[model samples]
Structure formats: structure tokens, C-alpha cells
Target: MSRVESAVGVAFAAEAPVLIVGAGAAGLCAALAAIEAGAEVVMLERDPVPRGSTALSAGLVPAAGTRFQAALGVADSPGLFAADIQRKAGGEADPATVDAVAAGAGPAVEWLADAYGLPFSVVDDFDYPGHSARRMHGLPSRSGAELVDRLRDAAERAGAALLTQATVTTLFAEPDGTVRGVEAERPDGGVERIGCRALVLACNGYGGAPDLVRRHIPEMEGALYFGHPGNRGDAALWGEALGAERRFMSGYQGHGSVAHPHGILISWAVIMEGGFQVDAKGERFSDETRGYSEQAAMVLKRAGGVAFDVFDERIAAVARQFEDFKQAEAAGAILSADRLEDLAALAKLPAGRLARTCSEVERLKASGGTDAFGRTFSAGQKLVAPFKAVRVTGALFHTQGGLAVDGSARVLRPDGTSLPNLFAAGGAAAGVSGSTAAGYLSGNGLLTAVVLGRLAGLAAARLV
Candidate 1:
């Protein structure tokens, strides 16, 4: 039950077939695949099973141009998906890398639905901003926790042993520079060594570590991190210790949420659907129609990624229209106010300036002025008098940058050479979205995790 007992040092008579660091989506998938391939696998997790960011995710998986989409009469191709990624990444992503992900995405999604029983549902005409096709998928349960539960079951049924609350302290390497295993510290202050012929790092990103952010990204100079507390850059540290190539440490995805007194991240998916984001003076800023990632980036760059959600009694009345609004309010994600002055005061904005800005917004609504994106407002009439304000801060949803890996999910060194006996996948592997302007591609993250994990598992099984 305790981390120390779970990870108490016991050397394997010989190296196990595969040792996966982190029992998140990537690690669980890799362990299950390796075990299914008749290889012995051990998975170490810093947190308990069925917990962590993977469980906390929204679990949107997008595999564009697949046979499923084609069956649904949706027109798409891996090439088009790759091209979109390349364009969004500003030509920073390697073409081969993007192609590899797109190529395996279809199979990976199918495997999740069929092999693991992920309860996926096909959604026609579901639009992901900036993408040409409607290729987004979601769970019928509509909760990431449900998907993670299924993954945990699959991994266990496949004979993968999961050790929770076990933090890998260092990767053990042979003299020839091949990773052999890992050393970990258990929650009970015990040291444990797990030896294996191959090591896979799926430990995710360092978005929660302010020190790492300050060192790698100057833009986040004073920005508060809004990711999982356990994401302290341990994976990045271990990779760096082995001279692994790193990328996109400076870039991170931002979330629009209410930062409560205790720093809890309430989902912005609510505000986006119900209310509008405004600046300190209560004026609309940035394109509201932009993708969540793009909006987060803009807010981070311009307004420090913090704003107030301004909504009137009508908008509040219609709050039940969005599931996120109800959940956020239930979870105390939204701050409330009755009058504009009191709302401004609670949101720490100048009352007079906020009132003036709101008045201007009302006039613009009446006259149909241009919106934040220069688009003529059609919903201006919805802005009735007596508005409410909720203070929202920027939160990080997931990390974009990670270890440099090849198409096969092999971790490459700085010189583009493969790390011996070492592979990476999931958020721990890099070169996915940092180069693309369109942030996330729906199921891109989870799909990549499953695909790269299977590849790593199969490849590790072949290693001597």
C-alpha cells in the first residue's frame, strides 16, 4: 500500500524485458503491449494508478483521414494532417516525424477502441479549429477517468506489474552508454532498483516546475504554473542526465480558468462556452473563436494570460447550456458577482475603467461593432445590462515539448544518434505540436502515446 513497500529494492535475477517509467497513458500502453508480446514488464509510477494528468484529461482523440472517417464519408488523409501540423508548427516539426505519427494514428485509435474497449464514439461534423476535416473522437463516458480505468485494466490483464508512488531517481546505464534500468525512491524513504534490458521514459513534462520554466522559457518569467503538482520535470532531468536531446522546453499550452484562493485550476471550457474573456478594463481582447491553445498563447503573451469573464444575467441564466459551466460552478471554478462595480472590485479591476469599458461594449453590441478578432459581432444583442465578472487565470493543460525521438519512438541523443536500449513516447517524447500553429489535433496526444508505446514495446522486445 505504501510507496516503499511497493518499490522496495529487490534486484531481478536478470534484467526484465522492459522497464517503463511512469504509469500514465504512455507507460501503461507500452507495458501492456510488451507483455502481450511475451516480454516481462515492470511499470513504475510516481502517483497512484488511475490518477495523474492522464485521468484528468478531457480524452479527445483525433485521428484524421482514417478508414473510420472515410466510412463516415469524411474526406481526409494522413498527408493532409501532416501538412496541417507542419504549417501550424511554423515549419519547425520534422516532416518525417509528423508523417510517422499520422501514419500510425489510425491503427492506434482502432486498437484503443477494439483491443482495450475504450468506448469511443464517432462524431461527424465535429470541428477542431484550423483543421480541414471533422475527425475528432471522444469517449461515450465523456470522462478521461473512464478511459484511464480501462487502460489500467488492460495493462493489468496483459500481466504488467504497476508500482505506484515510486519515483525514478536515475536511469542506470552500462559503460557502453546503454540504459539497463532505473533507480527509484519510494514514498516511504526507501531506495529500490529495477533492472531491465530496455527502459522507456514516459514521465511527461515539467510544466509545473517554475524553476525549469524560468530556465528554459523567459516568457514564463513570472507566470504561475497550472499543471499537475507531480509534474516537476523529473523525466526531463533523467533524460538530460543521459545526454538525451531536449526540445520545446520553453513552450507550454495554457488554459483559461479561475485561479481560486488555493490555486485550483477550474476548467476554462466553461467560460469559453458561456461567457466572454475581457482585459483588466473589462474590454474584449483576442479572437474568441481561436483554438483554446492559440487563445491561451495570446493571453499569455498579451494580458499575462489572466482575465475576467464578463457575463450578464441572460448569459448566467443560460449557463446550464454548457456542462463545463455547471461543473465549474459545482467545483467552485467560477467567481460570482451581481453588479458591475462589485464584480470589478472582486476581480481586482478599476471600477470606473471597467464600467466605461462595459458601456463601450454595450454600445458596440447595439451598433454591431467589430469584435476582438475584427469580426463583426452578430451576438452583440446578447449583451444585456447588469453584467457579472469572474476572474480567470492561465492554466497549463499539457506539455507540448519533450524528448527528441524518431518515428519509431526511439530517444535520440543531441547528435541524432539513438540512445541504446532507451525509447520514449507520449508527452515525454518531443516533436509533435510545438512546430504547428494549430496546437493540439484532437486525439493527437493520446493517439501518439498509444502508437509510440506499441512501437517502443515491440522494438524493445527485439533488443538483445
Candidate 2:
């Protein structure tokens, strides 16, 4: 399956001790770690910039036992974090890999903050569905674009050369499945054959690939893909050609609350903070708090492919911290009114049914009783005057499944043996979310990116 000769007299255009494909969070973090470990690094990016799915995310990374967590007097441990991952994943995830990522995540966050000067702080407010503690850490903006920009600047400052608009189209590997180099095509249709002692596949997963989504995740085949267009499953294809193991091809991160028409993501914090969703018929459907990822199919199947997220001014204030929410508000996606009927009229929803839904929600909160959907409305603060609503639709963010790797982030064969000098991270590797979207806990994507990227970089640097 090799497209180029592995050991023949091929003209080499460039070389590096460590070569990484794709310049997303994984590639940038790997470059940082490799440079810190005294190895020369080169990164190839298909786009003009380093933003991938990372830019589309909220930029939150969950960790255990970090200084940020301790500073807030929140007690957490890696063991507890691993347990939470397993429980959320239905015990289908690999125990060893879960343990390794849980252990490395905190240290990776600290390293990025202390060594690279990325301002990191744990979110102390609402907790994501499955996390036991408020361990989500992010930059001040709480936006993935900020995180990617900071990481890119840090990598460049550390002397890691980043080549943008360089698309790696083919791999040069030996018959024994040992990768030796790659052929990258330039925008002008020129090709460059680059050699490397070690290679890292950080190109991300296949959410943008309609054919792959139809073949694997058929449930979300025609859904809106909100991930990076450059995530066309190049890493998964290369891994297959190199005889590397692949797993959990159906797993993905699906969101139910992307502001439709505006294309801005309404933060799930709204729902976590006493907001509820109403379908076109103005009826509450499903337990929204089960997980945002699983809410995608629910919104699609039961909500006539669109729904309205209803919240109050208090919840809106909490959601205002997210950059996406502010963007949504600025784009006029957020409809507001002092009265519920007027707010429903503004969103073109059924006034009477919407009122009934709110009344039911209030009843649940007042009585502290579980609704028919198994979701309990805690007797917390009630939603007061000035209501808010947004039109939302489900979207596929990215795939969580790809090439399978070991604890060190080395690509593995079907028999569980490592591929020589080949590693995968981020969306390019099977994630800890098991084999479905329901198993996804918040921040799982960034966790794998930082933790496995750091491990892959350190291990690859050792080989050089």
C-alpha cells in the first residue's frame, strides 16, 4: 500500500528529527514537548492557519489534581478521574489508556501554563454532566481559538518550524509497516518528499468526510458538520495503509445546541444552569442534562430537526462568559423579551404550549420531583423576568475514533504491537469516549490531545 519508495534513492526536500502532520492542538502540543526535550520538530498544516476542530471547541481541558484545582480547594485525584471516565464510557474504554491520560492531563496543563505562559484556570462554576469536580481548565477567553493561537506562538518561539498549506498526501513506508517519510503537496501543485526519523499523525478525524461518516457513523450521516473542513480522515487512511490498528470508528462528538442559521455554538452552560429546550411543537423532550453529545440525536429525531433553547437572564449572564455565546448574542440569534409569551412570539414558537412547558418546569423545580424523562429539576433558583431563547440544531463536531495506540501514543497493529516510530494523537487516535456519543464526557477531546500529544512527543524525542 506504500505510495512512495521507502529506502530507494528518492530526492529528499527536507528532514527533521520529529515530523508531525496537521497543526491542531495535538500537533502544536507535541511540537512543544519535542522541542522541550531537545529534538528538532517540523509541522505540516493543510490550512493557512493552525486552527482545526480545536478552534471550534470551548477550549476546556479537564484534569485531576492540578494546581488550579487545588488553589480553589477542590479535591481531585487521577484515580477518581479515571473512574469517572470509565463510568461515563460504560466501562468500554481501555483501562490502561484511561489511567495514562488521566495521570498526564494535569501535568500537561501545568507545563503549558508554567513553561509556555498560557494563562490557565479551572472553571469553578457549573460542572459538566459526568465530571465529579469542576476540573475544566482554559484560557481567559475560554475559547479554543485562543488556546490554538497561544500553542502555535509557543511552538514557534521554541524553534519548531511550521509549514502551512503543506498537505501530506502520501506516506513512504517499508513493507514491514515502518513509516520513513511522506509526500506533501503544495497549493501550486508542487510536491515535497520529506524524511523523518519519527512521525506523528495529528491530522484529526473524519467528521468532514461524508463518505466515511456514512460508512461508520450512519446515524449522523447528513447532519451538519461543525468541525474543521481539513479533518478529512487522512490519518485514519494512512494508518490503515500502514497496517495500524483502528478502533471505535463510530464514536463522535455531537452537539444539539449550535445556533442555527448563525452557525454559532450556544454554550451548553445554559442548559446546565436551569435552561430547557422546547421542540417546534413547544414541548419539552428528553433529559437535556444526560449529556450534550447524546442530545444531538434527540434534537434531530424528536424536535423536527430544530429546537429552541429557553433560558432566563440569570442563565444568560452565566453563558455570557463563553465567546461563542456572546457571538451568538451579537448575531441576533438570541431572542429576548421581558415576557414568556413575547419571547415565544419573537422566536415564532407556540405561545400557549411554551407557557405550559415553563409552568411544568417550574412545578418540577418547586416540588423537587423527577420528570417523566428521568431528569430531576433540583429546587434551586427559579428563572425570573426577562426570558431568552435561541434557535438550535444538532451538529457533528468531530469523530472520536481513529487509529488505535498504546499508552505511549504509539500506533499499534491489530495484534496490539506497536508500529515502528509512528504515533497518533487527538482525533487521529481512538478516544476515551468508548464507541458512542452517549459515552462522551465534556472536554474528552482536548484531554486526549494534550495528554497523548505530550506522551507521543516525549517518547518520539527519546528515539531521536
Candidate 3:
């Protein structure tokens, strides 16, 4: 597409008011928020329109304690939400950021629902382990693409210009250390420089960059990329080059999935449904029914850093009852084997070991020693006859590290001093959840993306 570098002259020219890098959910939201705040915004995206990690996501927006809850007679508060997040994260998160998210989350959700026309419904009595209330909201489309489309439309209507296939190569900064704009690579191998008073980077994580992965998350060294192909950490690298401080560089969200023989992204959540994950010797490794983050940590640490999801025909049938399983299958997130021996052969595990594991699971079910989420499984729900197995491995969705920012979304230096005229939001910013698996809450990513994006937009707009 065409790129506009300068609308007029050098200094004091009427260029785009705000330059946003990455057209994913966060970038789009930032652009829209800036435009809504009366700023002329320009969004540059490396990929084509309507495709990114956001499009490939299972969009679940979590909102806890709001006016909608009061109408539904469900009680909740920001304090309760903050307490739950901190408790679940095991005190590893930044209290200030966590508090900010809790306090702003309700209003953010309200904006998404009321202003953005996002359809939402209040779920009842369905609370996460540490949640104080049943305030989790699921999108009607249940795909991040849906939300992105909505935001893109809104931004367009608000006069924000979106340029796709525009890859930002460098971040432009003033001599005073203020970020001025970005330099991007066009589709035809030409470079375009766009300048603005404010710049926002929301280009997502380093899942696609093996070098960054090895440099940061050492435990996931050589891990296969399960994120978007275009997500090569351009934003992070550029930020670092611009002297921005980074945090949690070694942290990432590990997803448990079956590594098909041909290398495809499979969902390990299916295994938690009715299948069993075991080591090469056919021994059950970790609690299969735990939260995804906890399960991912266990799978990565144990089971030789790889495991197999063993299920039977009956169990597979039962697994198909859930929407996640269906989506997993549609997304090629599951592998199949007809018999236990065949699956063992495919997975490179010993057939004898696999047989032993199945027998143990059956025994556990009969004796009521295996619950759904670490409880004993009932005998009636035991798997029968012909078995199946899928070779499983760990993958990542997003990075938990980036530019360290405070409650106001002001980018901070390693010395904990705020950077002037430089702000960060969304996944581009360091997250509140620290290194704890329990603290890796769902919907928090999107929450921060919207909340901090708005905060950063407002903060940047006021600078003008």
C-alpha cells in the first residue's frame, strides 16, 4: 500500500498526529483512542489486513465487577479483582499496575460493550479459581479477529489511517530522547519514514524470533514458533535500540499442545478434557486438569519437555462436546491415532509403557483417584476399547515482557525513572503478572491492551 511520510515540511509540519506501529488489537485500539481524543492517527502494520496473532486468537475478554453485574445482582469490586489477581499470581506482580488494571477494567469493558458495540453477556456462578465473582465476559464471536474488525471500523470512522504491509524497521527518536516516529519497510522493498509527535508500539511478542527466544527465555530455547509469522520482535528490538528499558525478557506464556509429526499447532487443552498426558514410560506426569498456564509449566519442566495425550474413541467423542475442542480440531490443533500401539509408535514412546499408563488411568477411574481437575475420575466415565494418542509439546502465545511502564502507562527506565514523552501500552509494555504460573490470568492481555492503550493515547495527546 501507499505510505505517507511527510504531510508538509520538516519541523512544525501537519503530519499525522500519532504514529502507531502494529495494526493488531492493541495498535488498532491505540489508534482509535488517539483519534477519538481528537488526534490524527496513522497506524502501520507489517502484515496484510485482518491477520495477526489477534485474528488467530480465541477471544475471551474478562471483566470483573461492573454496573452490569449490579444489574444482574452479582456483587463485585475493583479491590476484590485486584486481590484475586495478586493472590492467583502468588504476589509476583506489580501491585500498582495490578491495581490500575482492576480499577480501569470495569470501565474498559463498558467502553467495549457500549461504545464499541461489542456483544457481551453476564455468566453466572462461573468464577475462575481466584475470582471473587462471575464477571468473566465472553465475546459473541469468541475470536480476536471480531474485536479487531470492530476496532478497525471504529478507527476508520474516526479518521485514523491504517497502512497494512508496512513493516517498521526502526524507531525514530528526538535528540532529547523523545520518540518522534518510525521507519518502516514497504511491500516493494522501499523504506518509508513517518514522523509524528507521539508513537505507540504494539507489534506483539518475540515468538517468531528464535534468536530473541534463545536470548530471553532460555528454557524455551529452540522451541517452535506457534505465533504469527510476521511477529519477529521488530518492536522490541527497535525499542531496545532506542534505549528503552526491557523487563521480564526471559518470561513467556507456554501453551501445551501436541507436536504433530509434521509440526502443527495442536491444543493440549483437549488432553485435559478426557485424554491423559504421560511420559515415555507411561507414567502420569502432572495434574492434567489444572489451569493452562500451570499445565504448560509442568509439561515444559517434566515429561522430558514433551508428552503424549492418550485418549480412546469414547473419550474423543466426549471431548468433541466442547467448543474449544471443535475449534482445536478445525485449527489442526489435534493429532489422531487409531490404536494405543500405533500412537505409541508415532509418539516414539514404548508401547508397553503406554499400555501401563492406560491401565493405571483405568484403575484410577475405578478407584476414584482421578478427578477432572485433580480429583478422582468416576468409573462410569472411564475410557473404553480402542485408544488414541497425540504427541504433545509446549508452545507460546505472547511474551510477558516489554517496556516497563507504571500505572499511568508511562514507560520507565531500568532505574525506575519515567521516560519523558515515551509511553507504552498493550503487550508492548511489561505486564503486571510476574513469573508465577498462577498469575498468568486469561483476558488480562486484552485488558491491558485496551486499558493502557487508552491511557497512553490520552497521555500522549495531552503532550500536544
Candidate 4:
């Protein structure tokens, strides 16, 4: 397909106006937005495959008051979205940044659909934990790899050039702290300094760096790191060296139920439909109703870093409706049983205690009362005779902290002054959640990637 015309309908000059580092979702979205604003753009990716953590995600972006939600007869607003966030984070997030994300969320999702023809639909089955409404937009295939590919296609069609295998080492700047460009080294050990009027750091977080992980979040220091390998604290190191203000550096997102041995992620729909986590002793330690990210530490310390996600055949049937679940099942990531006792045997646990534990879970679900660990059951679904289960463990998926930015995603100094011509977005920027795992709402990752990226692009375009 031919490249789509620029949104401004103005051809870019010989020299581009914007240079973006890290050609993941943030860089690609920023490139598209800058091109639409009548600026030529160049994106650099260290990986030859041009992939990052975005490719490993489930591709859920929560957008309030979107056209899709309206079509479904749902009423929502940015105010309500902000309110929801504040409530989830206990009012610990930066008010300005939260408001900016809330306002741009619905438009960002629609823009992806209207401009790039991305196939997005609202997830309507059930709301995730901590979210009060159904506002997540995802692809038909429900794959984040597809989302990254779509963004790359859109950026290319908009005339933004993406270069792969270009490792950005550091930022070049004037004495006044104005970013001139970046110095990138080629795979062959050749270095080139690429200059631009504006530079954006979309390089993501430091998930792959063990030292940084321990420094910022000591709680998850020794846990399994499951994020993309390219994230090695480039953004944080560069930002700190440049004297950028760091906010909420302790926050991170954790996955409590990773399908191990087979390497595919088991969808949380199993838990959403009355599933529960049990140890080998067939005892429940913590509430499984908390969102995956918030429950990671609990699962790790309480369940000995290992547990089994036990669900019924009916819940499996509903979960298997999704492509990921189907693929996981086809890959032998799940075990099936005709009877609860058989499932217990497959899980290598005593059938008697497991039966009693499941009975208690069912009672809690029906009663709607809080459990000992403070988990309240919402869905009335229960585990019946036919059983399905997956052995799972906790892992750190993404860091929820990075360079702090202003309303327009401009990197700021410690005193709240914007750094000249320096911007950040996506995992490169501070997340919207509070300073811990307990505050992560569903779809916060992509919301920051898309909304902040668009804002940064437009703001940078006007400058250069």
C-alpha cells in the first residue's frame, strides 16, 4: 500500500524536524503524530527486528468516552476517567499528568482507528480489577505484536523513516542544555552523530538492568524479569546524567500468573470468571481478585513464588473464546480434568484439601464477603466437576517509572523548568500510577504510550 498523505497535507522539507529514539510503540506513534503536524521524522531502533516490550503485551488501551464506547451505549467522560485514576492511586499521581492522559485517551484511540485504520474494539465481557468501567480498546487478534506492527506501518505510510540496529549511546547537546541530537553506534562499532532540531526519548525503561531494578524497586529485585532485553536503563541513565527530574521511580507492574515451562501467558480471564490460586498444599494464601500487577508481590512472598491457577471448564470455555487462550491451550499450557480430583492429581496436590479449598472459594464467591486476605468476589462463577488449571509464577513485566515530563511531555529539570528540546513518552516517561504496584489500573501502559506520544509529537513539531 502507498504511504498515506501527511495529516497537514504539506510535504516535509529535505531535513526532518523531529528525531525519535527507540522505534517501539512510543517512537512510532510520535513519528506519526509529528509527520501529521507537517514535520519529517526519523526513528531509531537498536534491535534489528525493530521490536520491544510492546510486542510482548496483550495490547489493551483504556480510553474513556470513546466513539466505540458510545456505540455500545456507554456513557463516560475524561473527568470520570481522571476520578477513577485518582481513586485507584489514592490521589498520589501528578494531577496535571493524570488530567492530560485522561483528556487525550479517547481521542488517541480513535485517531489510531481513523488515521491508521487500526482494528480496535472495546473489551466488553468484564472490567479488570481497579477499573470501574469497560473502556479498554484492543485489536481483534488481541496481540501486542500486531499493535506494534500496525504503528510501524502507519508511521512508514506517513513518510517517517525508521532505521533498525542503530544503538543510541547518548544525547548531544549545547552548553545551555538544549538537545542537538543523539550519538548512535552501528553494529559494526562505527559511531555517527545525528543532529535534529528536537529530540524525543522513547527508549523505554530499565527493566533488563538488575542494578537499576534493585535500586528503584527493592521489592522485586530478585524476581523473574520477563520484559524485553533491550530495556537497560538507557532513558533513566541519560535523563539523570542530563539532570532531569525523576518522579515515581519506585513504581512497577508485575504479572502474578505467568504460564511457565510453555512460555505463553495465561490470560487472567480464568480468574475473572471465578478462578482461584492455590498452593501445592491446596490452600489459598492471598486474594486472587486483585489485578495481576498488584498481586505479584503477594503471590511471590505468600505462595513461595509459585502457584496454580485453577478454573472450571465453563470458565475455560469462555476464556478459550479469545485467540491467546486458544493458542495457549493448543500449546499444552493448560491441564484439563473431568473431575476435581483428577485436576488435583494433575496439579500434584492432595485431592481432599483441594476440594475443601475450592468449596471455600465457591462460598466466598456466592457470599460476596471479604476473604481473610481482603479479596472480595464479584463474579458469581464457581468451579464445578470439570476442572482446568495452569501452573504459574510471578514476574516483573514492565517498570512504571522513568523520566518525569510536563503536560506536553517535555522533560523537566528538578525545579520544574522544561529542558530545552527534550521530550519523553511511553516507558521512557514516568507512569500514571502511584509509586507502587498497588496503583496500576488496567490499560495504563498503552494509555501513556499513545497519549503522551501524540502530545509530545505535536508539541515538538510546533517547536522545530
Whole-model lDDT values for every prediction? 0.67, 0.91, 0.68, 0.83
lDDT of 2 by residue, 1-464 (tens): 11434645566778888999988899999999989899999999989999999999999999999999999999999999999999989998888789999999999999999999999998887878899988999999999999999999999999999999999888888778777788999999998988999999998799988999999999898898899988888889889878888988999999999999899999998998888999988899999999999999899889978999999999999888899999998999999999999998999888999999999999999988889999988788578889999999998998999999899999999999998899999999999999999989899999999899989899899988
**Candidate 3 vs 4: which has more TM-score:** 4
Q: RMSD of candidate 4 to the true fold?
A: 5.5
TM-score of 4: 0.95
lDDT for model 4: 0.83
- Native-to-model Cα distance after best TM-score fit, residue 449 in candidate 3, in Å: 1.9
* Most accurate candidate by lDDT: 2
lDDT of 3 at 310: 74
Query: Model 3, 108-174: lDDT tens per residue?
Result: 7787678778776654423433456776665664556677787788778778888888887765565
Select the stronger candidate by lDDT from 1 and 4.
4
TM-score of each model, paired residue for residue: 0.81, 0.98, 0.81, 0.95
Best by TM-score: 2
Residue by residue across 419-451, what tens digits does model 1's lDDT show?
A: 888888877887467733245544556766767
Superior candidate under lDDT, 2 versus 3: 2
Flag the better candidate by lDDT, 1 or 3: 3
